[model samples]
Target: MFKILFQLLAISAAFVLTAPVNNSTTGISKLNSQQYNVVPFGHVDLDDYLSNSTTFANHTYLSAPGSQNGLERRGSVHACQGSFTKKLCITGSNAANLVGALCHSISVALEIQSGNHNCADTGVHSVSDQTQGTVYYKYKTTGKGCTTTAEPGTIEGALHKFIKEKNQDKICDFVCIRLTHGGNWSGYVGLGTSQDAVKYSRCDHEIGSWSACVNGDKGDR
Candidate 1:
């Protein structure tokens, strides 16, 4: 009787400690995981790189099959949601000490469905690699360089966490880098639709659903 009582108390305590409060979720629907031959901007022509690039590097040009004549590493295509305004998502591994989570100066820009625009003077909307079936968790505060330029930082955090969790406690994939740089920064992460990418920001909402979303359906369903 004493042992049973102690076990019950321990379980109750565990529940109290682990229970979540005011649970909420956000994001878009995730695309099916598919292999993507990433053509790093470095490999593409200077003009093409500037137009369709997310990152800039001074590395050698290594060719990746299935990629345009200009590509280096082979990555995976994560998703492409929003009809009129779509996002071609991709992800892959990166060397440590390469990616940046540094949030310094930030700026915001919005492009309503219009013409072909270039963000060279500002920021580019490029994708990054993350673990399969993973999402980002943010913890932002003002006056910490994270406020003005929080989107990329938030993405970095999520990708890092997802990579760490997917590796099964392995350090081999401890880092994830981004493709975009300074000048063009957006500080939001919620739910985004092709029609309204700004307000619809969350990944789960963009991809599909989150377990916490009221209308979310577990995979089993």
Candidate 2:
């Protein structure tokens, strides 16, 4: 369909605009739907945000939970054999936004086998919320700046069609966000770890399976 073609062109353009990372997805695997929790998310315009072009691909998410269509979301996890890797896979809408996808940026997801290492993302996913806490989604929009907890909503504020599936066929990680900022933008990937003295705020509000906490997921298998 025309829509699909446009998306392909866009993805291709994304690669052309930025230098490609390893993205060699050889060992990639995704958890089943029961492992990752559904989340709410929205389009965060990192318009000219970063100081350079960055892509958070080719990384493995070792600690995700089962996802559920809590906030009216959809999709499920499966075998990511055809994906960019060989691990369990995910495919769902947002049930808790940053609690689900963004966690990858802040060391929320652990690296396989390396029980001591939490995952880190260079993009917005987990960085924004992990750094700003659970309030960024609403606070940023309201100009309040993470003053309180995030209210219940859909992915992209429950608006729909904002958080597009970045990688699925070529990558097991179904969500991705690529950006080319020029330093003028003022956002940084939060380097927080789940093992910190503090919890992942309200990550306890599991929308599905993947533990919302930084050090939460421990493999249900």
Q: Largest TM-score belongs to which candidate?
A: 2
* Residue 162, candidate 2: C-alpha displacement in angstroms: 7.9
Compared with the true structure, model 2 gives a TM-score of: 0.20
Instruction: List runs of model 2 lying over 4 Å from the truth.
Output: 1-45, 48-83, 94-163, 169-221
Where does model 1 exceed 4 Å of error?
Answer: 1-94, 98-152, 167-206, 209-221
How far residue 137's Cα lies from its native spot in candidate 2, in Å, is 16
Poorest lDDT segment (10 consecutive residues) of candidate 2: 212-221
How well does candidate 1 match the true structure, expressed as C-alpha RMSD?
A: 20.5
lDDT for position 205 in model 1:
13
- Whole-model lDDT per candidate: 0.22, 0.22
Candidate 2 per-residue lDDT over residues 111-194, each given as its tens digit: 221232212222212222323232111111111221212111211121112222222211122222111112222111111122
Whole-model lDDT for model 1 versus the true structure?
A: 0.22
